[model samples]
Target: MFSTRPRDADAKQFIAEQKTLASIDQQVDAFHAAQPTAPDPVIIEHPIDPVLQTGDSQLLGGAMEIKSPWSEP
Candidate 1:
């Protein structure tokens, strides 16, 4: 059979320990709250030129004529 009488010393110690943990949690929360949050990244996208977008045969022929820098003739 379980004892009906309360363990006062154990209960008091448990409560004190819980209070200490709660105080630590509060301090951690306050420390985080005081810190400044980082700003969102700024994305700058430049518009593509219409001339570069076109697939021209002359451009491809000119590009093909250029020898590879790694290869010797």
Candidate 2:
């Protein structure tokens, strides 16, 4: 009787866990459905040219300084 009680308790816990997982899955599905689709990319006729090097004249061993466009000041 003691062994059966533990087994029954474990079974109930497993069922409860499964129900929680199912609820999460439903919420995720609903969220996905509510999201908007991505828009198409636009094409331009003439794109602006990118700057290759910095205007700094003084440098060690004549090495050019490279800078990233996304870097913050």
Give per-model CA RMSD.
13.9, 10.3
Candidate 1 segments whose C-alpha is farther than 4 A from its true place: 1-6, 54-73
Q: Return the lDDT, model 1, position 46.
A: 42
Candidate 2 lDDT, 1-73, residue by residue in tens: 3564677889899999999999999999999999986544443333322343335522222333343334345
Task: Please provide, for model 1 over 1-73, each residue's C-alpha lDDT reduced to its tens digit, 9 standing for 90 to 100.
Answer: 7787689977999999999999999999999999987555544444444555566643443221222234345
Question: How well does each candidate superpose onto the true structure, as a TM-score?
Answer: 0.58, 0.48
Clashes of each: 0, 0
Residue pairs in candidate 2 whose N, alpha carbon or C atoms collide under 3 angstroms? none
Please report, in order, the local distance difference test score of every candidate based on alpha carbons.
Answer: 0.67, 0.63
